[model samples]
Target: MEMCNEDKSNDDTQELSLRDKFSKLFNELEHCEKEEQKQKIEETNRLMEEMDKEEFKSFIGYWKEMKCVWSLHFGETSLSKSLKKTIIDEEKRREGKNEKLLVELCECYLFLINTISAELMPICIPCLIKVALKKEESEEAQNEVETALMVMSSAGYWEFMEQELYLNEIKEIIQYHQEYHNLKRLAYQSAWQFLINRLFNDNNLEGMIVNELCFVREAARELDELLCCVDWKREIEREEVIALMRWFQTLALYFEFCHLWNEGYAELISIIVKAFRASRDDHREISKQCIHLLRKAAEIEVIKINDLLKGGAVDLIFEEILQSTSNGEILCDCLNFYLMISRKLKRMEDFKTYEPKRKLIKKEIFEKMEKEGYEDIIISLHETFNYLSKEYFIHLPINISDYFVNV
Candidate 1:
């Protein structure tokens, strides 16, 4: 009985020792200088590695509890003030080492987010934002901004939108990045996260997000300039081309939800059609995005059939279908888009509007399909037309497939 009591006492003492070690580590991490904090992080990692998995998990839980209590006591405002001062001091110092220190400081805050209280968000968010929005032209500064944006993205906090000034500052940064070809990819990623978070929460920022920042009225003009500048045939490095295409695709997606289609529909369609035609096999991803955006535009009725035909979208669609016979997904999308066009034209017949122009375009499309040896496409369209005829009881002014069959 005495041995068992002694064993229990030993276990209690060991548990207390472990608790003390954890508390010491947390306090050191919280209050240490940036370099010391990094060392503490390494120490903490080593300690975690030495612990059993279950013990380590328990330690994490305890750490989170303690951090939450600390955050509540110190408050987010106080934390933000301290962090802002550190950032300003680091910026003013302009030492090469200061960049690393700034990143480390930001990382510390990022790590704290896992345990930080919601009320502390205002403090943490603004600090990261100021760091991201700081106007330094150095590569390190760019990296810092990217890192801060990445950290903010990981937090996935839409509450930042509540601060109008901060939100606009972020928007301006995104807009500024959009003008530089090299930085545009990160800009797009940041914009996507920012816009999507707000969209998911149903927060509207329509009036503030405009042409140069989000959607440009002269998208076609810009696309044409890009095409002229890039010799798609000779440009073996497809990264820039692909990135530009993705930027346009993201813009189309953003416009879809915002009902801002009229803002750039014509230009978007024109650019997508051109991309579909110019993209090489190495750029199959770009081609796929083009098809996806086209399909989306068609489904939303953002790009009218007339506009599509005017943009020669049908010709490009048939070209992709013929070129990608073995690509089942692309083939499927092509067939689906063809069906949408047919249905749209059939609906237009109700108005007896542009009937001749529509018939002429349909004849031209099927003729091109037959000439291009898209017999499978003709068969699919024939089947689809018969099904639609029976389902909708709509009469075709002309036997659509008959044109393909005769050709």
Candidate 2:
């Protein structure tokens, strides 16, 4: 009984010692420079390595409970508000030092999160995101959001972060901050991290992750809006054109991967056709992206390809684009679009049900391409496509083929 009492006393003393040491180290981490903080992290890692499994588990539980570790002493909800208020009210703003404390606090929080086990992420991530989603465009706020996105993008947390709710959070972040380049880039990284894992590993794309949360249809809507709102009559700024080109590439990726096709896709094709007509002569890069997206859209017949035929998209390509541009890239994409059309025409030629599509492609695409002196390219591509179709088994969903019968 005496030995038991002594053992209990020793345990209590060790607990106190750990608490004291952690508190002291936390404070030092909060104040230290970057290199010094790295050293402290090494010390912390060594300390963790020295503990047995049970001791390490107990340490993690205690570490998670500490408010200072999260930099959320006033609570998670109020941390950003308080920091913003401090920046606004402080005389340190005049010296350009107002954000110093916030930066240091973010660094300390990052350090703590990096050191903690990924299993503890549920507790850590929500608080980090609360700070990250700070509506301000301040450098410190950007830093916080970037760090959170980087952590979310990292492979270690992907198993937990791939949940639908978290993916929605990433989408919302992107939807809200379309103007901030760094934020958009990192947010896209997080979103792709979730997508690429599910795509290659599971090979399953059912549920909201693909249909709604994948942002494919949503991106089509946004691109449609961008195309409609741009003043095509005037010379667009170079940066604006470049940004538009990037958006085109992004939407192309969505059309390639996400298979769900809706009315938004038809609208996207119509608007892109219009935008292509306006930009093809002036912006080769944008024209190329538009044609490339059209080719991808053609490959996946999940959507109504009739929309492209009806929109006079083929006429615009043959009449204006081929006549105006000498760019090899633009010509290459144009030829690819023609090749895709030929393949479609070949597939539908034998079926009486697809006679309307056959006539439409013949009139809008093949005749026009032949008129434009692309007869040899068209004939050779068809021969190649015919051989490949016979040799290769292209598996498509039954529903996709059924859906095409009506269009």
Candidate 3:
């Protein structure tokens, strides 16, 4: 009987020890959760610092192993899933209570992915995009899209571009939405990054970029809509105008290298001419961008002189020079564009195989220039040349008298 009593006592002791161990573990986990929830930045820093320790294999592995703990804390297993749940819950919360919790949660996720490892971005990005694409168009939805775009903009990983669904969804947002300028701006920036990556970083995607999907065409179409709808006169539209111009400039700058300039040439030249003609003191920055784009296109020979003249670009250029002769930058760009056109004309005239059309083309260019008041261009060029020559005599030793003999 004593032996039986001793056995029962031992069993009771073991069961009590097990209960204490569980209680200690539970408390430790709770403390960790509170610490992480309250001090995400600190916790993230701690995790990153400890990443090279012997215990943690890698940042990604450690985060994956913490899935269960995260599930217990946030009621979702994966960070992506947790983010989606938080967005939904925040939307359901009372208007007053919907504070910045969603933004905080999203920012935390963005920070983690941006700082630690973007290996998980493929999973996280899609979820964020879905939230962004919700048709509700509520304040919550717009916030979600904005946050998602912010996160996407931070990720430099190129694999995200490989996902057609992801790219298509972003393209849709940029194409259709005119209200969310911030979201649209970010989307355009992100798409530009993706294109840069594909063109410069990933060599394997060249064939796909050329044949499978032409982003240039899509970007051009969206730019057309922005130009058509935006009221450039409004102060509120300034940022949007700048964003659109930057996007158009990027396309004009790089599309030639991609051999996709033909896809966007006509539309781009038309828009650039319109922008240049619309230039005023208030819109000087956009005018500069338009001129910069024109210079890029002209330098690359993306559009012929005849094509530019036919598109009314010559008149616009001369007009810009006539209006802004005192503006050194405008004068320089206009002169450079004219010089490029003259060079192209000379090249055509010298082509032995195309000699038959050279005289006709030359006559056409001269008549167009004369019709658009070429005398103004010559006067502007002469004044600019003389002014610059005198101002920078040390750098410019040419004889202005001899240089203007032809004019």
Candidate 4:
């Protein structure tokens, strides 16, 4: 029988010092045959996990000196190992051996990140960023990008990434990859999910978030093109629609908070209107975001009401309300869309100077609602809204019927 390198101490820590134990494990791991190295590494990880913080830090020092972990995979020091070499090397390309090993390296890297201190993450980020943005073609390349994104998504490293100027890498990755590529699209979409979630949760990162709003607009435009397509049902999946909805929600919140919709406001409003009309009843989440955006536009009155009418905003809301009567969330959103505009026009002192535009907007909206035969539906919607408000304790300063009545 071939005996493994089992410790003879039999669980007796007094027999060997922690340093001696780590040394023994690392030495055995280093000398073990390739087939046995994985088992030895697992044992080492378990031992390291049992160590206290100080002991783990000391082990890091010894492991760095030995270069045991990365050396086994890449035969290069951790400091010098470039993920790109594992990705695009011509020799490795021919042998096909580097691919699996590259995957193992990624797994190992993640494990270390999970088990180690945040102080150690910075050293791994440069290589991660390189492969994340590398536009290579292969499963191995995809694995590299995915793993890099996984590391980037780790909250432990966000501060390091922010300090190191790697914060924009996710945006760059989103811009660099084509949305039509199924596999790569999933990776970047996931990265976007992580990024957007982080941005939404962190209140102190407002300044950093402002710079990303432009990129958000760009992403919204891409989504608009897809959603407006005739074959969008085939091209866009539910997951992609969910991502689009969240992005729109984020953009709408930004507009409401900052009133930064001056740049390309008309075009964006048009896109929002079109997306609402296109998605209709099939994607209520997306429709809810569209209504939210339109309400923000109404609250700010950044674009003239005539421009919104021309963009088909009034008709879009009516159609959405007609189709979404069963979906109370969408119905409430549509009602709020109109009430928001009414509230702004009725309450704002500044609108006194712009009464003609507000009156014209209100007149045109009523005309459209009457001509389209949606007045009764609007009345029914108001009744339902009142019922819901009482049942759910939903309170608004202004009532839906009072929207069209004189202040």
Candidate 5:
């Protein structure tokens, strides 16, 4: 037994600890021992053959059992020491042995088995997510979450439809993960990535995925879930864990806008914008999280148009722009979210629907611009109006100085 987990408290997790487990599993693989190694290799070959069988039935049960054992036996520090001793024993038995080659042989066998059979996945993925999240939890949770989320988003449904078997296994992993909130979220993300991988292979599925909006809804919902994890009231540093989760959330932001166009989903997106906004006051780093998500939303055309609208819950955008302007340097963020909003407001109405709303919007935008002392914005708005329509924007800017001059 190798010491895998330093934190004994997480022992209840089925994959126990990860540290010394894989190396030990590799070292102890009888396949490497001259006499026993032959038998184990033969057995592995038989298993591999069976994996390609007309009735590849035993694999599911074997992998399930493997998951059970690995989860329970992994990652205990004490276990790590035991495994280290095993390594020493194995090394001593072959005094003139090449450690690197032995390690490589073990890894190759494990890797081959892991890839050909889905068995290792049930053992590995959840634990992989766990360690990744646990390690990046602090100062970086958001980024970790985003990375995970992006993977899932890219996975989508069509990918799973093709790789149905792997997808099914992933579902099992998801079930195991659901019991733990962190894993549940990650599994959701992973499911999406699995689909994304498939989408690349098939254009029909890709087109269909694009036509439907599952990616959009799931991405926003996931971001909300990840962002909700930040409870600033009780401060603590689990940088490893937080970093992991943050990374996951960052991925979610990418998938939402880059793939699904979350900016089109006004209600949920506003919440994302606002939620990130509330955190800006706590720490500057958190404020960056706010900016990341907002930039994601800003990337879409629909959001850009909607940002200036007063109704359909568009007031939130205005409030966000104003609140952000007051929050601090975040206003100067790379996305220039505030600048986007201001530019939209300053532009004269382009479409018919926009025409009706332009009058009141012009007044409100002018008010905010002057309040912010953004004179360049006035010139830009005037230019925008000229490009769109001489008539639509002609009246709005003439009164810009008057609006500022009077106040």
Candidate 6:
């Protein structure tokens, strides 16, 4: 028996030497057909079984090389429908076994996901996730699912984020369920539950550590990404977006109360601007909220118009409000923001010189008022503004006059 073990160990050592000799030649691997390469790898792996322990472990290095090679191949030729079809078929082949393979495929895909630019991901991830979700006991599958969720959330695909995707058992078996980048998904889910509790479920907070599922970076990034995608001309679901806007503000308020200033500050200001630009249906309320935030930012100098204009932000805002659903409060806010933006730009080297900002303000207010059949209110508002302007200055001259006279 001792001699037999010695013989086996010797055989393993010899095989290890051979695989190690060939492993460095990975780049030239593409010349061979994929199936031929895979077959060769299998033969090598089989031979490795005779190798010593250290040699046998070199499969990991081989696996890594294969992944790099396959990834590049996947790039040069996008996943064929046949391959995707096979992946899907393999996924459905069993009650469960495909999960292991699915997970492995996902890990491979994730490496590429991190390496490639974003546009490619939308094409690949859905395919990857569809397979991963079929497996029940797959940690790798769960990981892939999480990464997919991360990309989805960060990309501001809210409808996708709202879906409860994991298999029931996966969620149950997960001892530590809240992974990184999945927190915003968790938060959105929890908030939905909070709504449901008011409807049919328990209104209890005991079971849900809602904050545990709170992914700060994901939410922050999603908001930032969405703001960048804010196109004033495109038709979008304004209500859903407004809800998202409110969710961000609520998150900011929560963070503020907890003294999480760093987490809340940037996105809070960003969401306010985005909310204004995104405002459509509940625009009266939304615009009012925007004005409230703009005023606050002005006081703090958190988001100045100069900074906004530098980012081409003012144009988007103008286009957004020009198309807003008219209401009393929104109208009032539009007028006030017009005044505020005018004042801010008045000194800016870029826009301070543009008469259109002031002209647009005057033109827009009357256009909106006229469109809304609020001519009487417009006239009244103008008269009220003039009266207040006079009254405001009534005390202005008297301020330094007495002191000058005394001097």
Number of the predicted model whose lDDT against the real structure is largest: 1
- lDDT per residue as tens, model 6, 305-365: 4444443334433444455344444444444444555444444435655556645544543
Candidate 2 per-residue C-alpha lDDT over 48-94 given as tens digits, one digit per residue, 9 for 90 to 100: 66666755543342232212133322222233334334433442355
Against the true structure, what is each candidate's TM-score? 0.54, 0.49, 0.55, 0.54, 0.42, 0.28
Q: Where does candidate 2 stray beyond 4 Å?
A: 1-161, 171-217, 228-239, 349-352, 355-407
Tens digits of per-residue lDDT for model 3, 189-216: 5545444444544455545554455555
Model 3 misses residue 88 by how many Å? 25
| lDDT scores of the candidates, listed in order | 0.56, 0.51, 0.52, 0.55, 0.42, 0.41
Better of 3 and 6 by TM-score: 3
Q: Residue 286 in candidate 4 has what lDDT?
A: 66
Worst 10 residues of 5 by lDDT: 60-69
Residue pairs with colliding backbones in model 2 are none
Off by over 4 Å in 4: 1-130, 137-139, 150-165, 168-213, 228-258, 281-310, 322-325, 351-356, 370-379, 390-401
As for model 1, its CA RMSD to the true structure in angstroms is 14.3
Residue 311, model 3: Cα distance from true site in angstroms: 2.8
Worst 10 residues of 4 by lDDT: 61-70
Model 6 — TM-score against the truth?
A: 0.28
**Tens digit of lDDT per residue, candidate 4, span 38-118?**
676687778887788767755432232122222333233232134334333422455545544554454344433323224
Q: Which candidate gets the maximum TM-score versus the true structure?
A: 3
In candidate 5, what are the lDDT values of residues 235-254, reduced to their tens digit? 53343234434444544444
Q: Candidate 1, residue 120: CA error in Å?
A: 6.9
